[model samples]
Target: MIEVRQVTKRYGTKTVVDALDFTAKPGQVTGFLGPNGAGKSTTMRMIIGLDAPTSGSVTVNGKRYAEHAAPLHEIGALLEAKSVHPGRSAYSHLWGLAQTNGIPRRRVDEVIELAGLTSVARKRVGAFSLGMGQRLGIAAALLGDPAVVMLDEPVNGLDPEGVLWVRNLLSGLAAEGRTVMLSSHLMSETALIADHLVVIGRGRLLADTSVEALVQEAGIGAGIRVGSDAAERLRQVLAGPGVSVASSADGELEVSGLSAREVGEIANRNNIPLYELSSRAVSLEEAFMELTRDAVEYGKVAA
Candidate 1:
């Protein structure tokens, strides 16, 4: 439901987002991710028409966000927290927003409940915690019941329970055939919530594919640890071209560049008894770190 075409953004002489092209489709949760200062916020702002693109354009459902007659009804965006005025109560704040968008009062109540803000709907926003403020912002976004919802770091200040709530909420929204796009720096959260991932590095599209595809394509070399009297022999047998073997102090070996089945076969053929044989693919975090290793601008020194 959302499309970005050659969207570029620059600041002064430096380009922050360069020729970005992608699509956020209905019925899927697209996770937008990148390292610090990777232009995620800028892109989100451009999508909602809060900021002008340097060259290209972004459209929601065939028209620029600003060009739509009922923009709030077409796209709901939560770019930052504390968007609500601190002086107003949560109910009044959403009331104003709903009114501004020509939405009915019932919509305001619907969103308040949807956002789990009924308990404190009459409280001033300034008294709310960061998480509460975030909830209020989300309520405002849902007031329009837009076809497309764009959230930038929706789980920033949420507790574990609140984070889980958002995860399920976004998944539910997408299941109903609405377009959902949110930028997050939390790999673990994205791994659990996102069906597809759009990875950016240095303001460029690093990888735009499903989370499963990224892990599979990385071919995370299987990790095998064995405890046996034949540990030395197993290491010797595993050492060769295409195979890498490293010995651990626990009298075990870490093997990579081969599958678990291959390792078992080699051990069996060589008459090496293995006390443990298991496998695991790379974590989403590791895969992402590997993908953006080159994009890292800072590094820690070895002690």
Candidate 2:
């Protein structure tokens, strides 16, 4: 597990992260989300000890990342995929990393196959495509089979198949009871993979909750759709103090403050014939936008 307690980071006179506190537990995928310039990268850097925190502390599995004798075995991270030497081959780069912290060469080979880089394992790093580089980075991250894995934008250059592979890979890692924390701008993918979320805005913690809880709290694009021949009558019947009913251009009733069952029961009680009643699915992207609307640094103005 990764624990960040009251951590803060400042660069000169500017504060990048402020008193942030959150935990990424084992057996779950935790998504780190925020808008641009929200200190996500700074916070991740602090966690892996790339950048020191100005105050508070960050620990990986009960100790600082640097405190572990075999840091690679404790935590594996991919902060930047293109940080490797251009002269080295993919296999050579991973082999070098394996040598450090006493990781064996066999494990390096295994990760290469796992990351689908076996065909290009001997290719020079500089000649690899963006997707290939991402695969290599992921292979390096899994090199030590660390108990905790952290990645920033893991699917940045991946194609559809590669994206699906990454989703499955992260899920499988978490299933093995490892702590998995990733930051991504893709909300749809994050929603599909992450069980929990730690949302930050301007370096402060906005939410640390489950995916279901966050979507429910946002309460946008959530309601029952009522289709009936007597749509106007059904709307009036369902209307109450806390309830809201809106008519669509197609003569469907968009209802809030009541479940489908309640609406159906109310309509049945009033002898209103209903043709269709279904709940509208809430989009994760919509909820994300709602939660971070105020926190957006470069929001666009209305035309």
Candidate 3:
């Protein structure tokens, strides 16, 4: 498991990560979400010991990364795909990492196949495309078969097939009881894979909850759709403080600030026949935008 408690990082009076507390537990995939300049990359760096936290602590498998005798065996991370030498072949790159960790040559070949790079294992890193480079980075991460896996934008340069492959691979890793924490801007893909989420904004913790709970909270106050002959009258009756009723182009009543059950009960009490009434489900992208709207560093203000 990965544990972060009251972790904070600052540079020259500018705080990049605030007092953050969250756990990426074993047997689950925890998604780290934030907008641009939200300090996600900074936090990931601190976790891997590339950057030290100004205060607080971060631990993987109950020990700090630097304290581990074999750090790669405890935690495997992919921060930048371009960290390898451009002249080396994919197989050579992974083999070199394995040698430093005393990992067997068999493991190197295993990861190469697992990453679907057997065909291009001998190709030079300089000749690989962005997607191929990403695959190599991932293969290197899994070389140690670490208990904790952390990735930053693992799907950045992947095609659709590659993206699906990564999704399945991460999920499988979590199923094997490894702690998995990943940071990505892809909401749709994240929603599909992550069981829990840790959201931050402006270096502050915004939310830490399960994907289902977050979605349910976001879907609250979403408008309800009602199809009834008395749509006009129902709109007037539903109008109140914190409530809004609008007519769609199809003459359906869009009622906000009311739950589907409440709308149905209200119509029933008022003797209004309802043909259909359902709450509109909010998309993950929509909910994320609403949650981080204020934290967007480079967003444009509409006139």
User: Over the stretch 1-303, how does candidate 2's per-residue lDDT look in tens digits?
Assistant: 999999989899998899999999999999999999899999999888899999999999999988999899999999999999998999999999999889998998899999999999998999999999999999999999999999999999999999999999999999999999999999999999999999998898999998899988776447889999988788788989889999888889989899889999999999999889998876778888888888887778889
* Candidate 1, 157-206: lDDT as tens digits: 99988998999999999999999998888889999989889988778899
Model 3 over residues 83-121: C-alpha lDDT tens digits?
A: 989899999999989998889999999999999999999
Instruction: Name the candidate that leads on TM-score.
Output: 3
- Candidate 1: lDDT over CA atoms? 0.87
lDDT of 3: 0.92
Clashes of each: 0, 0, 0
**Could you tell me how far off, in angstroms, the CA of residue 86 lies in candidate 3 after the best superposition?**
1.1
* Ten-residue stretch with the least lDDT total in model 2: 215-224
lDDT of 3 at 163: 99
C-alpha TM-scores of all predictions = 0.94, 0.95, 0.96
CA-lDDT, candidates in order: 0.87, 0.92, 0.92
Query: Distance (Å) between predicted and true CA of 111, model 1?
Result: 1.0
